[model samples]
Target chain A: MVTYVAIGLLAILASIKAFHYYYQIKRAPSQKQLSKLVLSTLRRGQSDRE
Target chain B: MIKKIAVTLKPYNRVPFVYQKLKICRNCRHFTVLGERDCMSCGKTGGLQPVEKRAAGIVRRDQWLTGLILLLLIVIGLLFSASALQTVLLIAAGAAAAALLWTLSKRFTPALRRIQLQKMFQQYSYELASGLAIDHQAAIRVFQEGDKPRTYEMLREIGSLVHNDQLKLEQIMLLQTFQLRKDMDLMLEPLLMDSFSPDLVAYIGEMAKIRRDLIKENTFRYMLQHEMYILNMPNGETVLAAVAGAAVRKSRYMTMYPYLLIRYARLLPKDRFLRLYKFAKSARSGPLYDEVMRIYEEKFKWDPDFQNA
Candidate 1:
């Protein structure tokens, strides 16, 4: 009974870890916006230089 | 006459994305492209990490926590197991699960890291911009202090991530103050601007004389786009000839700008024309090749350099 309980816990923990990684990867935001965000933010500094 | 200082600026680290050059403070979340070891805002030692590395660190810590939890649970189960067979079975199960978790995490580490990077940028967009702004101000203050080289260096670091015409202009203006030379580490591409500034044309002329290798398509395009304006400036034709001489350094350039060579071929010095002669000697007949031949026949028919070739 103890053996079965430990086995079940291990399987569940592994499944949870796998799911966490998969979900994190699947839900990744589009990287396209990232470049624009950085460039636009930096370009804003033109006001300071002027 | 002012002395020309041999200023050799440092090379920037190559990164896949410009933002990767930015470091965020762990304590203050401030962004900086400067090379200080500590966070400028929080004054905390060892608190700064490149944003990408910081994101990777967060992902790695989470992975470690999961691994620890799995290890702890496995240990607890082993200590409480009643029979040897049960213990053995539990050990095998835990090992299999741990391996599976490890494999999955390892396989998706890069994807996980990208997500973390995006999250950091999204969460702290304002901070990133403000941090770069702070760096710009600091550079300005340095400029106020009359440390032109240091200020240019600082601006260069910031410019890697914060590219704009203003930054390029600042760098160019500072460069104009300095007497440029061949030995100094200079760059051309980063300083090219959309608008025609006489200062930029002057810089291009100097680059042509000392570091002609740096001249490429964009530099050619920029120079040609403002040819009339450039010619309006004194010694503009001389500058164009130097650039043509630079174009002669590469066959690809000759192929791309045969018309340019044709215009400036007569102006190229004997040394440059000789190089053109050697290159044209092997190249299949083309307009540039014909022009080089024409220049040779017109000017160098009796020249010793052509005689040797």
Candidate 2:
């Protein structure tokens, strides 16, 4: 019975961790996307200044 | 590299004298006037640096909440489990997983970038402050050469070190050289002087109208005590007009504005006082408005528009 309870708690914790990992994956922009956005913005700013 | 060029451009390498002027009150971030060692706002000892911006409270709140929830889960596990050793092991594994996930999420958060930028700013400001302390001319060169944001940071640190009106005034003049689109009003607050030059008075008046909320009590006090000097400036009346308008718009400045106007009433010309009286009446009717009316009556022998209103 003790072993069963421990397994249940671990399952719950793992589910929570899995959900969090999914959220992180969805929200965070990839490095390539960020760099491209930055470079484009910089180019536009320089052109505007000139 | 810019810093190197700036030093080479200095004329005499004279200790700019202005860099060592004012101290920032760490508690309230108020700039104490020269010769004063204590902050008037919080009565704290003046320091060389004001507190920098910190990460938002929400980030920290989330961190605490995560820890608390994990602890609560562990506690529940301990209570329900029959074997203490198994429960301990389960709790430890759960805590490790949660902490790992928390660390991973925190690394990707915007707060990470904010912290990184703040660290960069702090290091740059420290070097700028030390360079200015050692050689004033070198600092000026950097100010001229550095981009707007860099110049902004340099001014922020230099503001904490100013000790006199002259230095404060010079700081404003230096700021005028930069045509930054970003609102530089808050950073400029510490450098506001009691006796503004004509142009500075106009700038103050413009800033007062646009960013009235940023005006500190010290500013009103300066206007009150140095009424003669401010009123004599070319833009003195305009400054007073803007200040009066600000007082009417915001209840915060209303406390000082009414008293300041009354004290300066006896000194103001008839037309000027009349203008102030009209401006004060335009705000919502209050005890302050009535008091201002009474002052107007006493000075002018009668309130011209009071009966009509």
Residue range A1-50, candidate 2, lDDT tens digits: 64446546655765675576566456544434433432333334334434
Off by over 4 Å in 1: A1-6, A23-37, A40-50, B1-3, B75-86, B278-294
Please list the C-alpha lDDT of all candidates, in the order they appear: 0.83, 0.52
Stretches of candidate 2 off by over 4 Å are A1-50, B1-131, B134-136, B143-152, B161-167, B177-185, B194-199, B262-309
Per-residue lDDT of B205 in model 2? 67
lDDT of 1 at B149: 89
Residues B169-197, candidate 1: write the lDDT tens digits.
99888888887877777888989999998
Model 2 clash pairs are B21-B162, B21-B163, B22-B161, B22-B162, B22-B163, B34-B163
The CAPRI classification for model 2 reads as incorrect
What DockQ do you compute for every candidate structure?
0.47, 0.05
TM-score of chain A of each: 0.53, 0.55
- lDDT for model 2: 0.52
